[model samples]
Target: MTLVGRTAAIGTLDEVLAECFAGVSRTVLIEGPAGCGKSVLVDTVVERAAAAGATVLCAVASPAEQDVPLGVIRQLVHGDPSLALPEDALAAPGVPSRVQDTQSFCAALREAGRAAPVVLCVDDVRFADDASLA
Candidate 1:
């Protein structure tokens, strides 16, 4: 479906993608009130990135999952098996281990970008699990 009234947002995303392709890493946050098409906009951007041969990783936050530690992180890593944490770092079924710490998460994110320009699209940040957001 065609997305209406988001030409400027798409244009900016195009610029950001270009910069990332050029080895200049950056992050873009798309924020808006609930039911304002934020997810649709993000999906459009992800589509563009995919068409351009970018590695796209996505995670969506849900109210039900908000209390689950590292819930968002788990979702993000689930799409890419190479992102699996070492057994030593893996927490019990639903818990986030101390070894799966912020430092390690950031390190992994950087590593993914280095391997291939990655477009990490996270939606519904307000509902993201608090621990994961940290």
Candidate 2:
């Protein structure tokens, strides 16, 4: 897919995907105004990653779910039996144990990564649940 004005951004993400496939862990955050195509950019990458046989986990956050603890994390792995991960019980927001919750989430993703190259894409992240953001 050739995006009109996103060649550079797409190239960067493709390089990230390449690195990911090469066994390098990567984190990408795409932030912009409501109509700036952040989702489009990420969706494009997700498609590419999936096409390349990479494991693609995605979540789109919204205000309605912002108060749901670990909501975004749930979106990533919920109902995805391929991950074969046990459900996590994240402590509620403002709990000091959130640090550990983050590690737990990472552990789950790390387990999945062991199976294949993992590409996690979260969009509209401004409204992600607090604990999920940890």
Task: Score every model by TM-score.
Answer: 0.86, 0.83
Candidate 1 residue-wise lDDT, 1-134, digit = tens: 58789889888999999899889988899988879998999999889888888888789989998888777778888857666655444465466557446677778778877856888788887899777787
State in Å the error of residue 92, model 1: 1.8
- What ranges in model 1 sit over 4 Å off? 88-96
TM-score of 1: 0.86
Which portions of model 2 show Cα errors greater than 4 Å?
A: 82-102
**Model 2 Cα lDDT, one tens digit per residue, 1-134:** 66799988888988988898889988888888779878788889889999988988889999998888777887887677654323345334333335665676687778888878988888888998887787
Candidate 1 lDDT for residue 121: 82
Candidate 2 displacement at residue 2 in angstroms: 3.5
Worst 10 residues of 2 by lDDT: 88-97
Q: Which prediction has the highest TM-score against the true structure?
A: 1
Q: Each candidate's lDDT (Cα)?
A: 0.80, 0.78
Give each model's clash number: 0, 0
